[model samples]
Target: MSDESAENLIAVGVHVIVKKHNFSKVYKVSENGTLMLGKNQKVEMHEVVGKPFWSTFEMIPKRGPSKNTYSLRLVERTESLNDLSGLKGQLSGQDNRLIVDYGTSQGLSKDEILRLQEAGKSGKEIIGSLIENSTSFAAKTEYSQEKYIRKKERKYMRFLTVCRPTIVSLHEMYFRQYHEKIGGLRMDALAQILCYSDVQADGLHLLYDSGCQGLPAAAMLNRIGENTSGHLINLHPGNVPQTAIVQAMNFPQELRDRHVAVNIYSFLRLHYQGESSMLDNISTSSKKVTDHIVERSVEKLNGETKSDEVSRTDTDISELETDAGENSTLFLRDAEKDADTLKRKLHEFEEAEEAVPVKKPKWFLETQRALDLLNSSKVRGLTVIAKEHPLNIVNALLPFLGASRPFVIFHTYREPLQETFMELKQKRNAINMRLFTNFLRSYQVLPDRTHPDILMSDTGGYILTGYLVQE
Candidate 1:
C-alpha cells in the first residue's frame, strides 16, 4: 500500500474514486463506508474492499433495496473481451457491412427502450437490441456504429470503477481538486523535482519546504521508493510543522517514522556558528564554564556519559554559547551584575538542555536535538521550495555542508533564484550554477491519429542547482 506505483489493490486509509457511468467522486477508503450518488444511487465499501482498482462492478437489483442490503455484481469490465482481435486498425467504411443515414435514422420509442432496459440485461445485450431495432441499422458505417455504441454505452452503463491513486493520479487529483492549498505546484514541476534532485532510497535528504503544505517532502518520500525507506530531514518555519504533503502521501507506518521535522529556528541556532567561532569566543571570555561545556561535548560525543544528567540535557552549554556569542548581550546579564550572577546564568543555561520540552515536538525531537544534528551531519543534498525567497537561506546553509554537496532551489519566478545564483557564482563555494525551466508537452498516443494535447501548461517555475565546493 505504501508503494507509489502500487495500485489496483484497495486498502483502508488510501484515497480512491468511485466512477459510475459519467459520474465520479473521490473518497478515502474505509470499512463499512457508504456513498450516495445523485438521489438514489449508492456505493458500499464492502463492495469495493479487496477488489482491484479500475475494475468495474454493477449494482445488484433487490426487492425494496435498503442501502446496506444491496449486493454488487462483479461485472469484469473486460470479461467480454476474451475474444478481442489481435490486430488494430482504423474503423473504415463498410468493414462491418453496415452503413447508416445518421440524419434520417429513427430511434426506438421510449416505452420500447425502457422495456428492453428493465429486462435485467447486460449493457452489451441492451446495446445489441437497440442496434438491431434501429430502422437504419444495416446502413450505418463501421465507424458510425462504433461511435453510436460508445454514446449509448455511456448513458445506459450501470458499472462503476474504483480508480487507483498513483503519483500521476494523485497529482491530477490534487492539481484539479485543491490547486491552491498544495501551493499551486503543477504536476510537471513536481516530476521535475524528483528527477533533478536525484534523491533515492538510503540517501539522506535535507529539505526546507514552506509551500503547498509539505507536498515537496511527501513527493520526495514517494520517489525514494515505497518498499525501501528513506531518511528525510524536513525544515520548516515557525513552531508548528506543515507536513500536509506527507499526510496526502499516505505512507505506511514503518516509512512514516523515517521523516524527521526540525524547525528553522532550531536549525539556525547551531548551524549559524561553527566550532572555530566557539573557540574564539572561549579564548576571549574569562569564564571557565565555556571550557567545561567543550569538555562535556567531547565526552558526550565519545560515549563517556557518567550520569543521567548530561544525557538528559537538550543541548550542551557550549552549543548555546555558539549562538550566544553573536548576541552575547541577550544571554549575558548587565555589566553592573556581579560575577556570581553571570556564573548562575551559565548553570541555568546548562540545565535548560535537560529540561522537558514544553511546546517542542517529541516525535523527531525538539530544538536541542536539532542543534545536536547540526554538528553531526553528512547529508548529501538540500532541496528548498518555499513561498518566500530562498536566497537568504541558501547562503547561510552552504558553509555547514561538506564539499561537493548538491543543492537545488525551486521558485515560481526567476528573479530570486537569479540573485542567489549571482551570490554563489561570486563566492566560488558553489559551482555548476545553472538556471532551469522545463518545457514539457504531452502527446496523445493513438494509431494514425495522435497529436499534442490541445492545451498545456506553459510554465513550471525555475530551478537552480549546483554543488558546494569549499575553498
Candidate 2:
C-alpha cells in the first residue's frame, strides 16, 4: 500500500456492525461483500473505507429513482458517553385500551403496508403511515400508543451510526452475545483487572487467556493504547493459541508486533529444566521432575507440528483477504494529536530493536523467544483469566515476578480464585490479596422517560488480585 492510499483508509480487516440498537439486525462492513442496506440498497467497501472513525454516515437516496443504490454522507457524530439529565420524563405507561374511539375508520390493507415498507420510506414516515392505517390507534391509551410507535420505529429503522470499536463494544459483542464461550467475564470485571494490574504504556505484563480468542488479551491491548511501547507476553496452555479476538481488534501492525505468545510447555522447560533455580524451592522429588519433563517434551513436540494451525488463528495477515479485504497493515488514527501521543510512547521502542531480552516474532509459539521472555526479570504485572484453575499457574509463575509486581485472576466462580488466594496467603508471596465481584446496573434513557433498566447483571465474575512479595 502506498503512503497516499494508506491515508485515505479506515480499518481494513475490522468489521464494524451498523445497527441502531444491540437487538437490531446488524449490517456489517466486512470482507464478505457489499452490505445490503434497507430496500435492497448496497454499500461497497470503498464507500465506508474513506470515512473517519466515529463519524456517522447515513444512506441517502440519489436524485434519480434508483432505490437499491445509495450515496454515503458524513452527517454527524455522537459521543458514547453523554449526559442523561436532559432526557427525563419521556416514559408513558397505560393499563387498558379504549375501543370506543375508532369504530368507523378504514385501515390500510396488508398488501398496502408491505408496499410502503419496500418503497424506501423513512422510519418516521412508515410509522406515521402505520398509525394512520390502524383503525384502533385512537383506542389505545397514551402509554400504549407510545409503545406502538416505538416498535414500528425499530422495525423500519435503517439508518446506522458508525462508531469506533473499543472494549465496550467488544464486551457487548462477545460477552453479551456468547457468554459461555467468553468465560462469563464482563466489561467491568476486565476493567478491574486492568486497573488492579496498573496497565500502562511501556510496561511488561503477563497474561494467560484462552477464552473467546484472547478477549482479555485484546482488551489489555486496547487499554495500553495499542502497544505504543508496552509489551504483553501472552501465555496460553496450548501451542496454537486462539487469537481471533485480538486480530479482530484491528490494531496496527506495530501494535500487534508487541504481543508475544508462549506455550506452557516451552516456558516450563526454561523455568524448571535446570536453566534457572526459580523452581528450586518447589518439590525436588524425582517423580515430580520426571513427570514435568515428560509433559514438557510431549507438549513441545505437539507444538512444533502446529505451524499451519497457529497461522490460521494468530496471524491477521490473511484474515482480510475476502472480497472487501483492503489488505493494509496500517492502523488509522482518529486524530493527529492521538498519533502524536502514541509516537512519544513509542520513542523507546523505536530506539531499541528489542526492548525485552525476548524478541517478538510473527509466529505464536517461538520456543526460544518464549523461553527468553519467561526468564526476563522486568515483569511488572500478570493477569490470569481462564476457564481452568489459575492457582497452579500463579504458583508456578509468581516466583519470577519482581517484588511489588501485581497480578490478578478472574473466575466466574469464587471457589477457584478463593483457593488461589489461600495458597498465596500460605506462601506469603502476595500482599493486599482480595477477592471480590462487581455488579453492573444500567438505565434506559430517553426524552423525559429515563429510568433504571428493568434488568441488571448480577455477576461480573470474581476477581482475586494481589501483588507479588518475592521471598
Candidate 3:
C-alpha cells in the first residue's frame, strides 16, 4: 500500500466480521476475554481502528497453554472521518442530543461520551482502539488499504500493562459503596471514637493497626463538635513492644484516677498474664488516680464555695496525715478518727456532686483527649480490638459518647456480648448508640443495605472499626 493510503486506512475505525470454519463454533472478544458465541452466531466488531490497536479487543488468558488451531477471519472495514474542528464549532449551536448521536455513530457509547466530556477516558484510549482493529475490517475500497496491525497491537498491549486503576474512581467506588450500606455516618462520630478509644489522654498511647480509618473519623468528629458543645481527645501509644506497661498514664488526670483505673487494671490483667505482679505494683503505687480525684474535688469545692477561706478545709489533709502515720501504732487511733471524719465529708461532697448528674470526670477526660487526637489531620481513626469483655469496653465508651456518633466495635461469637448490646437499647442513655454485626467472612459492606453506624464482627475477636472523632 502507498504511504498515504496506509495512513488513511490506519486513521479509520474498523469493523470486523469473523466467521467460524465450522458453523458449530462461534467467538467474540470483550473486556473479560474471548467468549464462544452460540452456534450459528457470528462475531462482529464495530469502530475498531486507531493508532494503538488492542484497545478494540482485550487480550485473553494472560498466561496459559496456547491453542494454535483457531480459525480466524476478518471480513469488513469501516472508516470514521468526522471533522473535529467543524464539530467543535457547531457544538455551541447544536443540541446536546444531536451531538450525542454523532458520538454514537462514531462508535462511542453515551456513557463513553459522557466520560469523554468529563475527561475521564484519555484521548489515547479512544485513538488506540480505532487504529488496531481498522486493518482487519478494511474493505477493497480506496479507504481499505492493507497495513501491519500487529505492530500497533503490541504497543497498545504494553500500555495497558502499565496503566493503573484511577484513584478517583477507586475512592469513589469504595466509599460510595461503603457509605450506602453504612447509612452514611458523618466523620464526627468516627473522630470521637478514635480520639476517646484509641488515643489516651497523655498522648503517649498510640493504637497501631494495618487498616487506618482515623482520618475520616477525625473529620466526622470535627463536624459534630461544631454542632454541639463537647470535648474530644486522641492518644497515641508509641512502641508497643517496649512499653509492656501499655501506659495507663495517657488517661486524663481525672479518668486516670477512677474510671480508667478500673478499666486499665482490667486491660492490664488481660494483657499481662504472668506479669500481673508488675501491673499490681503500678496500679497500687501510681498515685495518679488519687491525685486526679483530689484535684477534681478541690475544683468542685472551690466552685461551690465562693470564698477562698474555706479552700483549706476542703483539702484532704486528714487523709494525708493518716497515710503518713500508718507505721505509728501510737498515732493509729487518732488517724482512724480523722480518717472517718474525712471519709464522711468526702461522701457528702460526692453525694452533692451526684445530685447535679455530672458525668464521671475521668470518662469525660479520656473521651475528650481521644476526640482531640482524632481531630488532628495527622492522625486517622483507631481500631479497637477487645479480646476480653468487649461489652465492658462498649459500656465504658458509650456512656461518655453523644448521639448520631460514629464508632465501630466488634465482638466474636460471644452470646453475652450480643445480649449486653441488646440490653443497652432499653436504657435511655444508650439511645444514641447504634450497633451492627457482620457474620460473613467478607469485610465488604454492600451498597444497598443500611449499614450500622457501628459494625461489630463475629470473627471471634472484638474490634472497633472506622475513623477517629476529632474535636
Highest TM-score: which candidate?
2
Q: Please estimate how well model 2 matches the true structure, expressed as its whole-model Cα lDDT.
A: 0.65
Error of 1 at 49 (Å): 2.7
**Deviating ranges (above 4 Å) for candidate 2:** 1-11, 23-32, 35-46, 55-106, 226-228, 274-365, 445-451
Deviation (Å) of 8 in candidate 1 = 8.8
- The residue-by-residue lDDT of candidate 3 on 110-131, one tens digit each, is 5654454244333345445453
Order candidates by lDDT, high to low.
1, 2, 3
Global lDDT of each candidate:
0.66, 0.65, 0.34
**For model 1, where is the 10-residue window of minimal lDDT?**
81-90
Provide the clashing-pair count of each candidate structure: 10, 6, 57
- Kindly provide the TM-score of model 2 when superposed on the true structure, using C-alpha atoms: 0.67
Residue-wise lDDT of candidate 2 within 1-471, one digit each (tens)?
787666445655654656554542233354434666545666644466656655566565555566456666666642221221111124333445335544555376767766775666665666667666666666566656766655655555545566555567766866656777788777778778889988888767888886656788887788777537788888888768877667666778888878887786556665567433323323244336645665675555446435534554555645545512231211222233444555565555444623433323334235556556656646788888878888888777776566898888888888988888888898887789899887788889988789998765678889998888767
Residue-level lDDT for 337 in candidate 2: 44
TM-score of each: 0.61, 0.67, 0.25
For residue 333, what is the lDDT in candidate 2? 23
Q: Which one wins by TM-score: 2 or 3? A: 2
Weakest lDDT window of 10 consecutive positions for candidate 3: 240-249
